[model samples]
Structures are given as C-alpha cells and as structure tokens.
Target: MAAPLAKEQILDTAEEVLRRFGLEKASVVDVARALGVSHGTLYRHFPSKSALREAVGERWLKRVSIPLAEIVKESGSSMEKLQKWFQTLIHTKRSKAIEDPELFSMYNALAEESVEGITAHINELIQQLTEIIEEGIRKNEFKRSDAGQVAAGIFYGTARFHHPALAKEWTSPNIDEEFRLVWNLLLSGLKF
Candidate 1:
C-alpha cells in the first residue's frame, strides 16, 4: 500500500497545483486531485481552503526567513551581518521572481489573501532584525537606540528592494545602485 501522505507532502503538492493553475483557479480539490486523494483527506490537514493557502504562504515565507535567521546567528561584525542579511533577502526575492514568474505571482496573490500569515512572517523577520540590531548596540557598533524600532525602520526603509509589490522594479539596471544608496543612508543612521 502507498504510505500515508504527510502534511509537507500535501503542501508540496498544493504549491505545485497553485503553480499549475494559479491562485484564483486553484482549490483544495485541485490539490487533493493532484495528490491522488480525496478533498476530505486534504481537509483533514487544512480545515479550509483559506487555511491551506495561508499554510502555503507561511511555508514560502519561512524559506525566505531561514537564511536571514542564519545571518543573524553568524559570528561577524553586526554591520557585516546586517548588510549580508539584506543582500540575501533581496537576492532571494529577486531570484524567486525571475526563476519562476508564475510561482512568484501566485505567492503575491496568496500574500494578499493571507494577511495573518503575512503579518506573522513580517513579525518574524522584524524579530530577526531586532536580534542583529541588539547585538550591534551591545557591541558599540551602533548608536544607543531602541533595537526593535530601529529594526522596523530598517525593514520598512529598505522595502523597495525586497517587497513583492516592487518586484518588477528589481530588474532595473539601477536597482543595485538604489539599494546601495539606501543601505549607506541606513548604515549612517545606525553608526555612532
């Protein structure tokens, strides 16, 4: 007999179904059908279609956060870590958009409908930023300030480089230069 499907397997197939059919057309039935199972079985894993979409969004956002979180823990000057963190974030988002335009579009649509998951993802990213800022302050690399607030400022201030809404602009030749200018300005504010 085939092994019982796992939650990850369901999410994986759901993502494929989303990619194949796009967000508006994709449904729990589609995911189940793709997995060769009944919708009821998929429903056991995700109580509703909205819940499944949110879970998929959460999973995708986690992929983005995991690398940033590693940068936060690395043994380095916070300045280096901070720069690397944002660079990784921008690269990840841009590559995902470039590598799979359909999947990228689906994620943006899901993000719009999955506010709770998106908010949680944002909070997790902010918390990661907060840890890096706190370390910098502790090391005297950054001026004394509220780490959480500064982290939020950094995140929002650099939004154009990483935000999904601005994905199209990421392909512009000037995008890297623009990010460098913003990064330098934010760095100046953080340093003594």
Candidate 2:
C-alpha cells in the first residue's frame, strides 16, 4: 500500500520544480523525485509532465486573473482600467513565479517562441484591451485609433509586456509611480 498526496502538495511540488528548472527540466521524473514520490504516485494524479505544467499554469491564472478582470471591469473609465491593469501587473511581478530571474527568463523565451500557448496569452491581453478601448470610443471618451497599436505601445512600456524583472531598470520607474506616469501620458494622447 502507498500513501496519497494531497492536491496542494502535488501542486506545490510542481511549482517548485518549474521555478528551479523551468519547463524543459520540469519532467515527470524530476518532479516525482523532487517530492520523494514514486512515479506511479505522480502519474496517478498527473498523467504527464504537460498535465502538471498545465495545472501550474491554471494555478498561476487563478492567482492573478480574476483580480485583473475585476479592476478593469470596475474602473470608471477605460483609461482607468488600463492604468489599473498596469498597477496589478506590478504587484504580480513580485510573485514568486515572476521573481525568480531564471523562471522569468524562461517565460520570456516562451513568450517569444509561442511555446506553451504564449501567443495565446498575449492575444488574450490584446483582446481585453481592445474591448476596453472600444467601449471608451463608444462613450466618446477616446480618440479613434488602432487598439492593437495602442496595446503594443503599452507592451513597450512594460518591456513588451514582460513585467518588472524583464524590463530595463531605466526604462520604467518603480511600479506604482511608473504606472501612474504611464497612464498620465497615455491618457493625454488618447483622450478625445
């Protein structure tokens, strides 16, 4: 007979593996060995390494996604929504996942490579921002412009939308102040 792993324990082990070695090294055998669990035990819950990685990605979204949606939804204006999103990005930048330079670099590589649905993630962000901008345009609050281009510009400010660790230190101010300044300038250019 064998002991069972608590779901949390499995997830924690998976995250730790990803943090240290990233996707390539975060193999099933690696995670199982790291947790001192048998391969059979890990396979019982996660059929494969991709399955475990997906779970971790899902956890990452759970930690950051809803709050992001809420702030954008509740904002009094689209510009405010944009600003709030940037602020939230900063807070998430401090997350353990993002704090690890190697992990972050791995993410950057993935984003550029479109690995792990990385392009899908960026497309989602662009779509969300486009919707907000469209709403603002409808309300006569924003000048007519290409939402995709605007989204790309914001990406520039955030280091192609990578966040604090990925950005040049001189390219952006400290998070909150930097976001406020970014919104200030952006609004001036965007307002009707």
Candidate 3:
C-alpha cells in the first residue's frame, strides 16, 4: 500500500507546475508527475483542474491577507491602521507582480477563470476594511453612513494600486505619489 500524499505537497507542486507552464498549458497530470504521483492521486486531493487552480489562487491571496489581518487587529488610531493597511496591500501586490511575475500571471489567469475563490477573497478584504471603518466610526474618528458601502468603495477605488490586471500601470515612476493623492482624498472624506 502507498502512503497518502499531503494536500499541501500537491498544492506546492501544482503551483510550481502552474508557474512553469501557466494556466493555458498546465494540467493535473503535469502536477502529479512533478510530485511523483498519479493523476488519480492528485485528483483525490483536488477533484478537478479548476479546483486546483483555485486552490493555488487562494493560497497566494491568503499569504497577502494574513498581514492585513494583523494590521486590522493592531492597536492604533483607525486612521493610522487604514493607512498602514492600504500601504501594506499595495506593497504586497506590487512585490508579487514585480518579484515573481510568472507566478503572479498564473494566479491572475486562474483568478479570472475561477471567480468563486477570488470573489470570496475580495469580499473578505472588503469585510476587513469594513471592520476598520466601523472601528473608526465607533471612535468618532470617521463620518460615514455605511461602513460596508464605504469599504467597498475604498476597495474598488484603490483597485489600480493592487489589482493584478492593473499591475502594468503600477510600474510608472509616480505610482506612490499617485497613491498618496488617492489616500488623501479618501482620508478627507472619512474624517469628520
């Protein structure tokens, strides 16, 4: 009898295969081969190729989300926390796009195809922002009728800075300066 393969091991190898061949060319067979397992073995873990791709996307997003979650939990003025959260998000997204472009592209392709995972991730991010906005309102630091709505607006308005598809524009020399301008606009509206 063979030992069971770890799901993380499969996902790690799958990510590598996806990075090497991309979403259009990669397959579960390639992942299984890379991991020294049969397609059947990998299927037991992932169910389907789309599922595997979604898992990879989810893993990458989770890495970005952890620090943002920490930022949300930290002791600080809501304004400070909001600024730091946006900065960290932009930094993380830009780092992923610039430092490991191939992997970033793979995730982007997978994300476009697999909306369920990415939608859930985006919602979680908005939820995090909503909590921060709510905190600000509670502390009398911000004036807004709806934290959820404001969070969604903030997330969408700042998409150019962090969205993978918009990464090309981020390479411009003045991206940071542009971000500050946007941040100030958002801050002014949030503050009483």
Candidate 4:
C-alpha cells in the first residue's frame, strides 16, 4: 500500500490537477485521482472542495509573500529595500503571468473564490510595506506620515504593474518605463 498522503502532497497534486483541468472543472475527485487515492482520503485532509481550493490559493499567495518578507528583513537602506521590494513583486507577478498563463488564471480564479484568504494575503503585504515605510521614517529617509496609509498608497499606486487583473498589460514594451515613472513620482513624495 502507498504511504498515507501528506497534506502538502495533496495540495501539490491539486495544483497540478487544477492546471490541467482548469478551476471550474477541476473537482476534488480529479485531485484524488491524480494522487492515486480515493476522494475520501483527500477529504480527511481538506474537509471539502472549497476548503481544498482555499488552501491551494493561500499556498500560492504565500509563495509570493514569503520572498517579499525575506526582502523586508534583509539589510539595506529603506529606499533600497523599497525599490527592491517593488521590483521583486512586479517580476514575480509578471513571470507567472507570462510563463504560465493558465496557472496564473487558475490562481486568479482561486483568489476570487477565497476572499478571506486573499484579504489576509493583502493585509500581510501591506504590513510588510508598512514596516519598510516605518524604517524609512526612523532613519529620516522618508517624510513623517502614516506608514500604513503610505504603504497602502504605494501598493495601490503600483497596482498596474503587479495586480493580477492587469496581467495582460504587463507584457507591453513600455510597462517597465511606465513603472519607473510611477516609482520616481512615488519616491519624490516619500523623500524629505
């Protein structure tokens, strides 16, 4: 008999199944079949199809957030860290959209279905941005302002480059130049 499937393994298989079948048609049974397990076995780990889908969405969001969190902890001036953070965020989103369009679509669909998970993911990102802004304030690198508000502004300000809904536009030749213009504008506002 095969070893009992780990939850992470189930999530991994489910992601693959979703990629193959697309979100609307990919059922819990599909993931179970992919894993060579009975659907009931997956139920032991994920409870329901919705629960499993939520876990997959949460996992995908974490893949993006975890790396950004590391950038937050790294040693750098606030300005440098903030630039790197945004660059990384744009690159991550762009690559996923360009390289794996189907999977990227699946992720967007999962995001729609998992509102609470998406909210938490957005909150975590804003909190990371807030930390960077607070550091800039402490070091006198940025003007004194509400860090959370500034963070949210910076996030929404750059949404054109990073937002999933705008993924198709990311492939434009001028997207990077446009981002630089926006970044410079935001930087001017942040500086003392």
Candidate 2: segments with Cα more than 4 A from true spot: 1-9, 18-27, 33-37, 44-47, 54-62, 94-116, 146-149, 160-165, 168-184
Summarize candidate 3's per-residue lDDT along 1-192 as a digit string, tens digits. 767898888888988887788778999999989988789988887888888888887888898898999999998799999989999999998998899887788777777776887888899999999999999999999996599999999999999999888999989999999998998998888999
lDDT of each: 0.92, 0.66, 0.88, 0.93
| Model 1 C-alpha lDDT per residue in residues 1-192, reported as the tens digit of each score | 778889999999999998888888998999989999899988888899999998888888899999999999999899999999999999999999999887888887777787888898899999999999999999999999999999999999999999999899999999999999999999999999
TM per prediction: 0.96, 0.65, 0.94, 0.96
Candidate 1 local Cα displacement, residue 189, angstroms:
0.9
Pairs with steric clashes in candidate 4: none
Write one digit per residue (lDDT tens) for candidate 4, span 56-97: 988999999999999999987999999999999999989999
Candidate number with greatest lDDT = 4
Q: Which runs of model 4 end up more than 4 angstroms from their true locations? A: none
lDDT score at residue 131, model 1, on the 0-100 scale: 96
Candidate 4's TM-score reads 0.96
Off by over 4 Å in 1: none
Error of 3 at 116 (Å): 1.2
Evaluate candidate 4 by giving its C-alpha RMSD to the native, one decimal: 1.1
Superposed Cα deviation of residue 153, candidate 1 (Å)? 0.5
Q: lDDT score, residue 135, model 1? A: 98
